[model samples]
Target: MTQPPATPLPPPRERRRLRESKSLSQAQVAERVGVTRETVRSWEAGRSTPKGRKRTAYATFLASVEAEHAPAGTVAPPSLNSRSAGRHGSAPLTRSVEFVQPPVRTAEPVNCPHPTRPPKTAAEAFDRLYTHTAPALVRQTYLLTGRRTLARESVERAFQLAWQRWPEVAVDRDPAGWVRAAAHEYAMSPWHRLRPSHRRPEAPPADAADRALLDVLLSLPPAYRRTLLLYDGIGLGLPETAAETEATTPAAANRLLHAREAVAEKLPVLAKPERLHERLAELAGAEKLQAPKSTLVRTDGERRTRFWTRSAIAFTVLIIGTTALTLRTAPTRYEPVPAPGAVISGVPPQMGPGPLSQADKKLRATLRGSGRGGPHRLAPEAG
Candidate 1:
């Protein structure tokens, strides 16, 4: 006889719900399913689905979990074994297999209702995102840079960039995350070191423990520091932290490990991950890092855009005018240059009468004697 078709898995959301209802962590589920935690996360996130044996195993695990926690009076859906038993006139299996049916394939499109209303305008949507995300982002940036001014600047700049590219930002899976990454990159930029204002260090937190913690955090390499903040300070998953920091999962893990080790070495009290998370939260909360108003940010971004737009237009116009002028005035023909004057190769030198020799004296006397008749003789000769 052929084996029954593998039991169909529930929807991703339902899969996550069932796992959570059973008080299971992704790691625990992954351990049971012989996959990595990231794989389990992906399954729940709807990024990818399991296939073959993994699919059957995952379905079985979720089904058993649902059966255990399901209400007493609720009717359960039939499973493969249950269907088999019923075919043989045996008692139906009691376990609930009521996985939500997957959406039916259809030739025509269907318009499912959205859970929330869309924002009225792009500005309104951007403002809502900014208001919701900026405060927390500022604190996180502060933790990264250890400078309140830089943190606020970074967040504002990030939001400005997001607004500049609102279309892209609007469709992003995690807009807040996009802005956060931007802010983090700006705050951690090595260029900030060259700024005169940023040359000096910001004052440490007032509390000794906080100061020590912040010091230790700043002491870690920028990559390690960022990974630690994203993972421990902000409580992002390892995979998400890796993705945000642009590193391989294993590399992110290594950074986190080394960062934690460095912190624990400096502050033994925060050796535990949970304790470190708490301390980080406490440190961030203690600061008065407030983001600028969303309206101000939006307006500033608009103003900046306008300024640049006008500048670009003016620059283009100037370039066009200059090119036209050059074309109009430039000579069309080549002209040959006149050659420079040169001196004669050979010439006789004139001598003064006083410096002349005896021949010169006799020639002068003869010329004086003949001078009176020279004109008359030359005239007769001509006639």
Candidate 2:
């Protein structure tokens, strides 16, 4: 495999010349280079060398400065120190350095403008989507789970999934809807049951009526709760709610109906549409403060790499676990030993089938019946 060439660093003397040619202060150069003024001074003073991207930027900047400051009708010097008895070098040329200072506006508020340009890449699109949709997704998740941390976790996981599938997600007709569905799934996951609940049992409401209504709403099933939130709290239609929850329109409507009935049983005030919307708004709006900042997601290729790495690790662990368990639980085999006196001196214990013939079997049976008598004499007395 071939390796790419590394970027070249500018000579120390060349760096000082570039700063001077541009009439830029060390502070300005430091800011542009994203380093401290002392670092830039060290580079220019030959005490240290610029490396990596910093060195490349220094070289590129110097080239541009030379191009801009070169005098007309005269070719610029190929190198900064190539001046021995040169015309301009011999002459005492003085250049005026202007120090432009502006009044400090520390007391004034700063307005950061958002980028309005269209995204040209999938990464840019993902960033834009995170910035715009993170708040709403978090709030929606909070409304479903009634837990701030869980809501943030769900939204983050959803965005992570979106990032892994950015190729599909970036081109989807309803990217936000796709993310919302993921968040909802995460918020209602059974995995949460395995973990001890560290979050608040329920969110505090704005008023008594809202509190009672919220208690009842949280008691309902996750699907019904989400349906109510999307349909009424956020003012989304049944079709959109169904799409977000991955349910049919009729299913969403049925859930909405049941959710309303459940709420009405606790607080009759919720039976009224206006009252219900008001309470729902209050319940959902309480979560606005808890919406978390959007997170960056790994790209599709990176996700694939991680997936394979995790799979390999899991397989190795599985093999190790199987071997350990087998070793621990396998039955042990024991060889049979003869009785202490059963073996005669210098004779091996008989392990084969014994007394196969009728006469031998009858003789063995007679010996077994002589348990209380002395060993039978070999001589046949009565027979």
Candidate 3:
């Protein structure tokens, strides 16, 4: 009978045959390859693939099989150590290789999104989101740190950063959450920490009395202050707070409650916002001062709206002015002229919406666990 024609071997099969020919088991080949026997078995069955550095690794294993089988007279003389060393990136064939195979590893790294997050010029990102977020970030920070100047500076720096990577960050699951996180990071920066004047902030609003309270709150560790603000000011739930602050839900809740108790015990003045401001102011006056010029976010909404509105209007006028000049100087009068100022006067229109719509507000409020029976009350003794 005619011998069956020889078929060229696949990579895995070739590797496996090399082992079998050397009288080595799957486990032995796996040991040479620095992998488990199951991996070798999978390779033999063609149930898996090995690529990249691992491909070189497998080739090295086959080379080792050839060397081991040398005593058995199966390996061809010329096709021995020389070829394997070159393929395995080891020393020249004159020297022996001490093979160290890698163990089977599937999860090697965290899947970072940075590579694919769109490349954004930081300035472009800031220009897109700064106006929308800077004010709230500033206000929230001021409330927490009691340092209006530092808060103002902190928000600007944070938003500046956000702007730098706007495309990448805005596409994240929660852009606002990113803003909050950025603000926190900014608050902890050396620039913010070094400026001592910002520690005792101007009292919130009209309260001269809240200064004392503010001082006490500001004196707490940063974690406590952040926990307090996210809980008391942002009204975040425990789990939501955990996601924001990088804590477990129970930990976040306990932190909030603990911080609240600490603040109350340390400075009872916060029970009344007015008194809190006054006390902080007194503390500031009594403390030997470090006078860094601070930026304050003292303006209320209408002022901010006017400031941005004026800016937008001024920008429009400049654009129109430039366009008009371009049209006059152009080789053709047919170049499209801009419409009158009235058209774009309504541009960006107004602040329009707040954090969410009323419907969304209700839904979020509903999700807040109903505050049912006020957290302390049990369910009517289960009837």
In the order shown, the candidates' Cα RMSDs to the true structure are 16.9, 25.1, 35.1
Q: List runs of model 1 lying over 4 Å from the truth.
A: 1-117, 340-344, 347-383
Best candidate, lDDT: 1
Summed backbone clashes in each candidate are: 0, 0, 23
Model 2 misplaced stretches (Cα beyond 4 Å) = 1-114, 198-203, 288-292, 295-383
Each model's TM-score, in the order given? 0.61, 0.49, 0.36
Residue 14 lDDT in candidate 2? 57
Candidate 1 residue 199 C-alpha distance from true site, Å = 2.0
Model 2: lDDT equals: 0.62
Best by TM-score: 1
Q: Considering lDDT, where higher is better, how would the candidates rank from best to worst? A: 1, 2, 3
Q: Residues 1-383, candidate 2, lDDT per residue (tens digit)?
A: 99566666556645654564453556788888787877776676567878778877776777776566433211211121212112112112111111111111111111123333456677656665665456555655676776778888888778887887788987776676677778888889978877777533644756776566667877999889988776656445556667778898778878988887888888886786546766654555554444333332344336666988999999999999999999998878876787676546887866888648998889889978886587756786795
lDDT of all predictions: 0.71, 0.62, 0.51
Predicted candidate 3 versus true structure: per-residue lDDT over 41-78, tens digit per residue: 56655667766555568866666655664443221211
- Candidate 1 vs candidate 2: the lDDT winner is 1
lDDT value for candidate 3? Answer: 0.51
Q: Supply the TM-score for candidate 2.
A: 0.49
